[model samples]
Target: MIDWKRNFLMVALSQFLSIMGFAFAMPFAPYYIQQLGITEPTELKKWVALFTAAAALTLAVASPIWGALGDRYGRRIMLLRANFGGMLVLSLMGLVPDVKTLVILRLVQGALTGTTTAAQTFVSVQSPHNRSGVVLGTLSAAVFSGSMSGAFVGGLVAEWLGYRAAFMCSGVLLLAAGLLVLLGTREEFVRPVEENGSSMEDRARMFWDKIGPATPILALISIMGFVLLFDSAWMPLLVQEINGGIKGAAFWTGSLQAAGGIAGFLAGPIIGRIADRISPPRIGKISAFGAGLMMTVVGLSQGFWQLFAGRFGAVFCAGGLDPVFQIWLTKTTPAQSRGFVFGWAVTARALGWMAAPMASGTVAWMFGLRAVFFISSALFFLLIPIITLIARYLQPAPQPSAPIHAGRR
Candidate 1:
């Protein structure tokens, strides 16, 4: 009776809006710190690292809890919470009195807002399992497309109206997204009877038990998440360096990210379809190698256009990494426990996100900005062997043969 296609379309639309809202102001964070009066380059870098890591730290802790709650309560509610929470936090971010206040808000943002994870879990629960690759891939495309639109428009908004205005616009978009989800999507989530009397400890143990078999895949997912985002916080600074000043730096950073978003938008569904047909491990290996190569080019680039070109290629290939792994995870895990497992998956990725800024910040602080890109490239290459080793674990389980009747034609 559930109209899954309609549900997917609605969820995808909400996801696009949600990610667009976040991207509007987030890519401009380092510059926002400057507006908050941290002009010293070292101080700026340190604060940037802190700002980026703070959210990841809390999200890492909060995701599994939210995920479990999604299963117990309803995925739709969790999706709404994420969008609405982001709307509030991001709006407040534009009004922060100081860098510390902004960082505090960022921490809150992480704890409350994980729209991507929430949306993905919601869609995963609703859609047919066989179509997971396409469904999730298309959802990822929405994310990339949203990011593309957000970054492009946001750059111009920041350039003309200033960073605060960009944050305000982000809030409005999230509000719209939340409303869309609230009114448009439907989830017939039946509460699991066993969860009613389960204590917190019992729930936690059950969650782990479901997730235990997928530990190896989740571990790689975490590492890949770190590799994917490792250079993100420092990218704005790199653009500044390339541009040779603050003038138009915000626009250029947004433009560069927008370019990558464009590539990711195109790559997501294509790579996803391919992943559905081919072995995800094989796709992962190829994507990782290409991403590493492109990242190296990005690191060595001397100008804005060169960086843009490299980023486009890198994002195109790197887009496959998450969706492919997600497809693999869906295939490996039990259906009923997906929400809990995915929450932990978000936690694993959050851990990676948490570590990336700190590590990249240290590298940029000690060596230089370009060094961070090189290190990120190396990490991408490292995933190749890891993916190969895990391919066995990710293989689809053998099916039982149909029993033959003696005289059946």
Candidate 2:
């Protein structure tokens, strides 16, 4: 018998390192770009938008292919591919001579790396159906904790060494993560048998049929993903504005992001436990509203401490959104099709990720950086009613009892 708990622990640890590695240098991108000689505000914002959107676009295209491969091969191998690919790409990011090359590398990163999706698919496949909420939530907590540690330490690293050095450190962390997963985790994936001589169209049709039931849930996940990451690319710039200059801005940006990460870390498992018992839709509604309220506070705050407080509260509530939906998706999907479905799930979220930057970047360019927060807040609020509607739609129709039969006599 598989030791699922051991498997979960190992997967979680690897996820932590992977996310930490990415966060280490990524959150400092705007400043790094400044160092590359693009100092004008509008031009800077455009490049920042491109940097985030480019990866998301490619990830959207690539995730489903990778997911299908995961099912055909094994999820564990996919995990290894993502980790090692990220290790290669992120390390090279530090060596790029200009911002254009950096953007190109990000595109490649999106194509080659998707550690979160790989990790989630691996854990979901191994975990008990009944305990999906808790398992996934704990996994999310590992991600948040990783982000907290990475951002905190990375900020200091960026401050003392330079942004390039931070990226190098990130590469090393990814190397460690890749090794951990390779040595520690094991999967008993059995490949599904293909029908003899099935055409590409038949396979595509079958794929959609399997994933159809979860479409609404997938849509919600995408929206939430977009809302969650909408303001991230420009956050360092916001920190600079609050600090009144670029000097020491990276450390403070990292500190603020760390605050959010810590909040997410604390909130994930607790909310997940609650979701497993209580109605996940109810939890989702409450979390969305709370996140929106807190985001308003973040948008309106004029000082660093105020922003920090708001960031903590915002992420605390926002952290519950994805795992709750994931739990629902996990329950709805068949075990055999999970890798396939989750690949689409990742694609959906990547679509959101792709859109967020372009939309938020536009708002930032037109209205100002703070305006992006307000827009993000509104998007969160919009989810409340959407969740309510989706919950109602997903409810099974009441079945009518057959008429009482006289044949019993």
Candidate 3:
């Protein structure tokens, strides 16, 4: 048997570093976008849209291929790919002459790299089936922690140092993290089933075949995409107080982002492990509904704290969704197609992200930011029904292949 604790720690460490690098680059992108001096609302929208879309498009398109590659060649190879490729693209941004080059390279980076999937696959393979939720939550915790650090530090650093310096720093951090993954983690081999286990082999073969079908897994992915869009809308929906400069816009903005990341880090594990026991669909429905209720209440808020309270709730609800869905996905998938399915899932998530800024931003412009929150809050209610349907109708996934289960999961 594997030393589960040692392996999980290694993977978690790699994920923490990789996620930190990604987080470092994001908060400061707006500063660069503003520097480009194309601030017309529509044009600004287009630029922001294009930048996010590039990543979304790439992540969406590349996830399955990365996942597939991970399955056949080795999941470790995928991690190395994400690590090295990420270093290359981020470095380009630091070196690029203009915003155009940066966005183009970012999109390419998104297409080529997916650290999250690689990390998740690594843990999933080594972990006991029952403990998947707990392990995934631990990974989620690492991810959120990295982002929390990045956002808090990124905002402060960008404000202090120049934008170029921040970009260069991000590239360096990502490169270092990737090297750690290459040097430290061991790859677990996945081979064809033994002849004695013909029936099991045939069933496992079928799991691989199921990977391509756009089934409930994809549905979950698509819904998650919209969920993020809804989450993104929250900022645009901050209401008249922000436009009036209630109490330092920069602080508020950074605080909101940091707070959400923190909540995600703290709550992700609890939610994920709960899903392992109570069934994913139940958890999904509850979280979606809770998120909607909280966000809608936010739209009704007049005070900044009220708005932040809503933000916290929404983040908490959404935080657990990733691990829950990941558990669902890996469990249902055949080992051969785990990469493809997970990849496409990431791609779908990316598309949702691309749609978010535009959809919320445009709607906020027309109807007001509050309306954006109202609409998003309202829209999320649909997920409640969607997940309930899956829980009620679909067959439960069979038990996982090994004693990977650990923790309460």
Please give, for residues 1-409, the per-residue lDDT of candidate 3 as tens digits. 5576786887788777777777765655654676667656566556765676678777877787787677777787888888788878876787667779878897898887888888888778778888889999889988888777776676566656756666677777778878887777776676544334358878677554655454676777776786666546346325325546322333455566677778888878898878788878778778888888888877888777887788788888878777887888877775655666777778777777777766766775687557778888877788878777766657657878776657746
Residue 265's lDDT in candidate 1? 93
Clashes of 1: 0
Q: Tens-digit lDDT track for model 2 on 26-59?
A: 9999999999999999999999999989899899
| Local lDDT at 55 for model 1 | 93
TM-score of each: 0.94, 0.96, 0.86
Note the clash tally of each candidate: 0, 0, 14
Cα lDDT for residue 398, candidate 1? 100
User: In candidate 3, residue 379 scores what lDDT?
Assistant: 72
Sliding window of 10 residues with minimal summed lDDT for model 3: 231-240
Ranking by TM-score: 2, 1, 3
Which one is best on TM-score?
A: 2
**Ranking of all predicted structures according to lDDT, beginning with the best and ending with the worst:** 2, 1, 3
Indicate the residue-level lDDT of 315 in model 2: 94
TM-score of candidate 3 on Cα atoms, chains taken together = 0.86
